[model samples]
Target chain A: MSTASTGKSLAFTAGDGYHDDPPLVAGNLSFHEVTDLVALHTEKKTPMAWYGAFSIANIGLMILLLSVAYLFWNGVGVWGLNNPVGWGYAIVNFVFWVGIGHAGTLISAILYLFRQKWRTAINRSAEAMTIFAVICALLFPTIHVGRVWAIYWSLPIPNQMEMWPQFKSPLLWDVFAVSVYFTVSLVFWYVGLVPDLATLRDRTPLTKKLRQKVLGFFALGWNGANRHWRNYEKAYLLLAALATPLVLSVHSVVSFDFAVSIIPGWHTTIFPPYFVAGAIFSGFGMVMTLMVIARKVYHMENIITINHLEKMNIIILLTGTMVGFAYITEFFIAWYSGSPYEQYAFINRATGPYAWAYWTMMSCNLLFPQFFWFKKLRRNVAFMFVVSIFVNIGMWFERFVIVVTSLHRDYLPSAWDYYTPTAIDVLTLIGSFGLFFTLFLIFLRFLPMVALAEVKMVMPQSDPHFYEGHGDGHGAAHDLSAGKPESDRGKS
Target chain B: MLKELTRETKATMGIYEPRRDKVYGLLAEFSDPGALLHAAEGVREAGYKHFDTHSPFPVHGMDRAMGLGNSKVGYITLVGGITGLAVATWLQWWTGGVDYPLDISGKPFFAWEPSIPIMFELTILFAALAAVAGMFALNGLPRPYNPLFYSENFSRVTDDAFFLHVAASDGRFDMEKTEQLLRDLGALYVEVIEDLGTEQGPAGDVRGEAVEKAQA
Candidate 1:
């Protein structure tokens, strides 16, 4: 009781006993220490491992570039496109990358609105991932159009050609939806980075004049004015609120690209919700994959502790379960509808030509995450990392099954053909990952990977009343036990 | 004078103003947020109108302590959202139904159900843009030449320390009295921030004085 009043205890003393929830940030770190932990990665000399990874990513980017060039030089004919299967790896990769983009916004926007303080540690990098993933996502659609030059036809801008894109079409909606998603997400990420940029600007040594100026320019000369913080906080809140619905809508619109069609497997009411859940599932998986590596490489084990990894695992389990439920519901509805074509589609997915892909998706997305049900497995970094990789593979196959399986064998048996991706298709898919990793690795090198200011705000020292009942014990007490868990005060 | 000139180079481009000898404010750096919060309350209680607190992060209860009400950024966001909705609707309706009508599946040229996605996306885009832009516009940021930056200790406001500044523009501001009041509030450091005049050499003396006071 005496220790509780001192405000030095890690867990608050509830009525019965100690309520010891795991701290969001491990280790008793000071504000400056947290800043140093994140900023060091950017400020210090680039690690050899970063360069190694960057080179590999760049090679992927090169492959992507060459593939796109070849695709343009020839046409969509370079890939394995037939009468029934016009949509191939391009659409699957588009949906797959777009799904990966969801977790960042989910972490930055939805979790923010919920006041899940733990999001502070991971949100910045996650948002960056979202931006890069969306970039990769947008790449497919842009290049997918055989005539990349006339892509502007998708827009509503009046031109010499008086015709407008079909406004009623879900494809048109996707163009607007994805582009707007990218723009708003960029703005949100930048806005959140401003304060942190200012910190970096101040810390920059005078010797690095150019670095300081660049950081200063983007920082917008932020002075940490409370007046500014008032408006800034409101703006952040508003953006988060807007992004929450937008995140859900973006994926739904993506699913519309398929679900709006009359294809038996694609035409289902469950697609939108299912797609959104699967996007979040895949996104968290990607975030977990990157985070596990980044935290280890950057020596940020304290800031991004096992607790954070476990929490992400919990989300993975929840979304993975939702995705599996959707799969069953879609199959059940197909049979329940008594539509022969629909029944055939579902049956073919499981026991037909593409059954291998379907089964692979079922196991990876549905069964692999089941390991997270155990506390020990969820906390095991290596195990979670492997499952995360599986999630990525499974989610990609899920899209592949939906797009190719449905289209390859449609309403007519004569249209049935085995769809195999050409080497170009494989190269382009691999290249998109290169582009994603390159952008991500660059972000790691230049920017504060963690939200320093927000992390500081969560530290106990940020509380205006932290020292009210205590004496000289405040400094050492806070330094040693930084994450005193907002207590039962309920503000966090 | 070198200090003042060096600080100016860091100011945001295209907005440098050279003013004659004038006091920017008295900046008091507190060791922790609690001290700054209490100090802000004290300053408010003493009826100062042109005072602001600065910290590495937004201290909870700071707005109320500083008497700032709910931010107006939300209103700006609302306006932006409505504008986006209206524009998206008009763009879709006029372009699809009236300007260049298409007969697809015999569906109506214009309908709310089909238009909802675009409308919703634009609403969010515009609202988010307004929120960020409105916040920057209200803060009068990107004006890098804040006189407070001239104080070396002020840099830490973006780091670990908390600070409060009572502007010289305040109606009740008295230099000595404000400095003494901040000290009474147990500020770790108090220094007079000056807007260096174009007539420079003597500014060096003022800079030295500020540094001495900060050290005290």
Candidate 2:
């Protein structure tokens, strides 16, 4: 019975060889211990180390707010968005940040659908990343509009002007797409938080009535009723199912902003699939970057194991290959079409003034990910961190090349001009990261950085019938008939 | 958490008094899932319809033990998805075709092709939002208070212990009998759940306890 099909035997015992080697979660944790460990982050006194990071992140948030203020006060013209290159750093940053958010949904929704148990370790933080990344992303379009006050016009709300956003416009589609994606993500994230919030509520000593009240209010009076779980499970499954399509459609619509246009490089049928793949690839890169630091700083190595990192690396490799293939297909299509404008768009991207940026995209996305093929490199935290940074940088340049190159030299040579980001343009891009990291750091400190409820669910100790108390599922890994769980590890 | 909880002794004070409206239910705690699962079956077998099993996370087969039917959240989502599709299609068709018909490039204003993306997104959005709201409604959530909170031992319900609570309002519920049944079924501790007593529920209603029982 090809071991894979006999899930009863191997699933709890041995997994894909990678897991058998070092277990997905170490330091065998019981239902109670896991709760204590995970909840400790939120309930404990603020560590001095946390304050150090928080201060740095606050400075970043301040920079983000100032840059946004500048953009809104001066208008879209404050950036390098001119007549010929109307879509500049702003659009590039918008697409880049949006792409980074996709990995979060993929981990929480798509992985949940596929029943990837490994996701239990990383889903909370990944989802948090997605929320913050989207928050940073929402800023670009608002500032890009020039009239930030009239941003509400982008929505199909009833007003005295009787104005309706043109349904034909992809920009209008983007407004719907991003907003819906954000709302769904927030709901999904919040729903997952309820059970854990209850845990935090329960853990709060009666002495701290204030903390209990605050946490209890949001916990929604959850007593972990079995009936409530039944509904919660079904609701979560439905949301995951709904979010699965959204993860795909949201990026597809974002890709439409370019593909619907007549611009040679932008108008391609392969754009949707290509953008989706690129988004996952880049998003995973950010996940890796954040997770590596998080696991180290939080002493979460027991839960966020090396095996988990390896699985994510494998995905990065797969998506990176798909992206590289998309790049090649774009070149082939440009040449095959025999349209001089398309050919020039492709050729100029490589050999023209922007070749440096083009090569940066290629090396970071295509070349660096190849290193992950080495199991050792992929498992090495330091090496993986550097490589993930490279992937993110390359993904950013990929957008820059696609946006700037296509618009810098349009069909009319007279209108062609070299696009250069003004100081505001550069600062705003940096400020978006400032915004993303600021939100992320706050989430890390205040919220349960790891999914407490989910992590407990994965523990064999949680099963009523299993008495095996080995922290890493080792006891159950031996026999299905193991009865009467003992406290294998002493109470914390 | 690191301060070594000053209220650590909130475990149980023995024979918890049910001070008038303060009583919510009889909460029986089991140290492990095996005991809790068995106790859940006993609670169901005893015909206690308004009882539930609570643990740090969901336990396998606990639903069957609690005798709960499949959740209706999925159906709610389906209806919500259809509503969104209808709304999106109707909104798009009316706005583009009838309300403000501006023929730009001779393409049909209500073309089905371009509308699919919005349709798909809207359907997903509506369905997802419905699922969450429906779940919260079904579970009677956003509730700031539950009498279970008054039992300090119940806090471990989210940590190490597994508990089966039989509400005081259940048709089969008699406090002494249910407590006896639970203790016999391997309960490490049995504590009476008491309310915060911050508000009264229409004279003798016991609002928090009444609402939870009424759902069952």
Candidate 3:
């Protein structure tokens, strides 16, 4: 690779026909240098551990697919859907997957807007995880509706029956919210992929024509021009601005599906914000869980640095605190509302048939993230990974508590019944993990796991003021020119 | 008649020098953008077509200072947004209205309220798509090859250097006079540059031929 300048002069004239030597030393990393780095990460074949993980994911996927087939053939009764507990594992999984998807957009878009440079390495993979997780989430809702074919009816339009979907229903709101969230997230992810796709297109073997064509189509003819870069940046900034509000609104609306209902424990005003915070908290935990393993596997510690992990830890701690506050607020409101039904619901959650789930939720979400408050603990990747897994388990338990605990002890004591997950329910939930991992593995094999262009932009050599070379060959002229007042030097 | 013309015309000539020492000197030398614009206007009115301005960062109104027109990005975004809204609406109607019919939550199949989120998403999606497409269309992306790229020093655009090049194609180009003008305008160094057209076609042709031969 040629690292030295090719001894070419660039002219700048004040008036027509006058030529000037290029003012600054031009330093650029060759295409070969960039490719070498990419090859280092991607050239290696799938590791033994990845194979093991993939096999496990495959098994889980098999179970999930089989269960879905059974459910479709035999109806919702194949799981544990009864009168009092109509929504068991399906709704729980739906919320869980949705929560998992939240952190990707938050890390990529929200952090990007704040100019957090640490996000460059992890954002690509994290966005891929978001898309996959949302795909896993969509499954539950589609199946939970029982008549899977009738799913289109949720969309709003004037039908042949001359009727309109009731706008007041939260489920209808969910149909809108989830679809929008998914579409925007997909666009955001694909747009980010364009530059990296071009990078791949440039480096791939000549024989890989199909790969080139596919990547070329996706790249949409990006050339890294200044004008293209300027607009690319503007569009990205605008998308980030748009996404922040959408992330908040989508989760809040999902929470409304429960909160707007007359169920004593679910019908709280604090549900929306509480759910959003919990979603972010769990989402960050999931990112950490995946990233710790990914960094070790791909040897990307320099790019996905310890500093990035620490930042994520801080967010986890903050959201954990918010979740703890919401839990306390719920209890206080239940007492303050003075309605016997509401009061009973809280007490039942703590001491009822599924008290274990409630306590597990409290400890996992509230207690585990507290460890991150210590700088040492936050920096410990092994410890962080363990805590992240625990947090995920804790969040799943939290949803179980919310859905089952509230519905089990309704206003009418005669109608109250215990909710239990059958074998199919358990298999389906485990299967979702398989689906998530399968998609993630495929992404890992193909995509540029790091944002290479964004990283190059941040390198120190790219700064012209930092380079102390003038057009003249002599060193003293450059220093004497540099002797201009500090404020005037490179002032624009 | 020539003597009378000379008497009537008081020549107020302004000279410009390329300040090679400081890449971003042009930005700081001018007091403000307004002053820069005024200077540009003065030069234009005097029928002196050989001048340029440089800045470390993209200065707002600099295009207008150089007498360039507004870009067409806005128009592209608008058309894209409208198209997106229409497509989203049409897709919803086709799938939910025409293709299948089933009641959800005891409500009519096609609910407009639920469609707002998709509508908003599609609008943004279209706008963003248009923004990037319009940018590429106007600026000509994927060029992969340019005369500027052949000049190794042109990489300074990505770095801290700022520059303005008055092309040789300009009608008033005079090497000695332009150099003197640049020096008068406080340019530290001025040099003439040769255009080198780097050949890159043989590689493309070779690749294409190899593919064809393999297929054969």
What overall lDDT goes with each candidate model? 0.85, 0.80, 0.66
Chain A: TM-score in each model = 0.93, 0.92, 0.88
For candidate 2, give the DockQ: 0.35
lDDT of 2 at B2: 35
Question: Model 3, range A1-492, lDDT digits (tens) per residue?
Answer: 122221122111111112321121112233234334544455466678878888888888898899999989999888877678777999999999998899998988898888776677678888898999999998999999999987777775556766555444678778777877887788888778776676665555557677766766776654343334445566667667667877887788889889989988999999999999999999999999999998788766645767678889999999998998899899999999999999999999988889999899999999989998899899898999999998899889988899999998767789889988999899899989999999998788777776666654433222222222452222112233322222343343
Off by over 4 Å in 1: A1-18, A472-492, B1-20, B197-208, B214-216
Among residues 3 or more apart in sequence or in different chains, the pairs in candidate 2 whose N, CA or C atoms overlap within 3 Å are A28-A471, A467-A485
Model 3 bad stretches (over 4 Å): A1-35, A43-49, A157-164, A468-492, B1-203, B206-216
C-alpha DockQ of every model: 0.47, 0.35, 0.09
- Per lDDT, the best of the predicted structures is 1
lDDT of 1 at A413: 80
Report the interface RMSD that candidate 2 achieves against the true structure, in angstroms: 9.0
Candidate 1 residue lDDT tens string, B40-137? 99999999867889898999999999887898899999999999999999999999999999888899999999999999999998998989888888
Which candidate achieves the best DockQ against the true structure? 1
| Candidate that would win on TM-score | 1
